[model samples]
Target: MAYTIDRHPGPDAPRLGAMVLHPIAESVPRARRWFQKFIAPYNPACSVDDCALMISELVTNAIVYGRSDDPWVVRVEWFREGASLRVEVHNPGFPASVRVRRPDANDAHGRGLLLVDSIADSWHSGPSPFGGTVVSFVMADAWPS
Candidate 1:
């Protein structure tokens, strides 16, 4: 699938970046790499490793649970909000259906959201104005103050 990356900045505006990806298992790694590269300039302040891990889980959840009959694409967007970085994943799923699950120690799956909740400074899932569900998380002090 063809992917589009947008990096537009203004003098007094926040730095913004976005990408569109095919909703497939392969896209999870792609999303993680994209997020790491996009936030590289911000460096150690952002916790690139943690951010990448969270993005991986979020994208995986979108691919596995957000699937629908329609040709819906996964949209990932990030922007600097003051000293924090906010990342959002948009998919064609109901926001109410997105929840954190407590899997048993023997389970091999279903720990994605738990990782996200633990790592993100703040996170939320809600209906998107763009016509789908949006799962977003923020990393505090991601940018120099």
Candidate 2:
């Protein structure tokens, strides 16, 4: 598992921040803080709390479901788009499925995507260009007064 946060911003990825994290439970909060700070200056309207919660869910899923044999590297990224903020979480292993389905209340697992679906303005999961799954979500930008 690698522990590196690379900073690279570009026209294509305006206000972008990316990091490669070990697929561990602690990586979830680390990603949340990094993403919150990354989008703060650019997307002032972003709800830091919402970003925190959603980021946690995404990274948690990656850590819990990613490949175990290989060092599972989770890539987290965010960028400003038009009037929205986009966040993507990538993991090294693909899941059997990444669809949102309601789990029974008694069920202690499988609520990550459901949480993301309710919080994010829009989101989708699919094969990443690099190999594995990429879960992404967009939220409407709210500028501060």
Candidate 3:
């Protein structure tokens, strides 16, 4: 079994795997729309939807926390690693050690990663060798939610 990982993908980079990059902003729903369009042609059923939400949460954090007008980058990269699908989002955020903390019970936010951590079969956030932090999640579908 071999695992293939591609960087900067398109028709020129090969089509076996799909990738999409968008400029991130404060509007999470808008960002998610790009994810939806990017995955729509390739993914059927609800897998893409779930993947979009995962992307939304990551991009939302990037836009809200990055606080930079240097044209933030939002990339959704995925490929099959054995039987599981791995998804990663890259942005120009400082690759510092970050911990998603739970706020007060009534807080309206700060729960996005919780949802992601809960839903993803295996998930983590770490520094990308290229730049910034990358939030990567792997879904096996067989893993208990």
Candidate that would win on lDDT: 1
Task: Report the lDDT tens digits of candidate 2 across residue range 89-135.
Answer: 88866745677878998999888889889888999888887688899
TM-score per prediction, in order, is 0.89, 0.85, 0.69
Off by over 4 Å in 3: 1-27, 40-46, 67-70, 142-145
Using TM-score as the measure, the top candidate is 1
Score candidate 2 by lDDT: 0.78
If the candidates were sorted by their lDDT against the true structure, best first, what order would they fall in? Answer: 1, 2, 3
Error of 3 at 75 (Å): 2.2
Write down the TM-score for model 3. 0.69
Query: Where is model 2 more than 4 Å wrong at Cα?
Result: 1-12, 142-145
- Candidate 3 CA-lDDT value: 0.62
Judge candidate 1 against the unseen true structure and give its global Cα lDDT, from 0 to 1.
0.82
* Predicted candidate 3 versus true structure: per-residue lDDT over 78-143, tens digit per residue: 655545667776666776745577889999889878878877888877877557777777778422
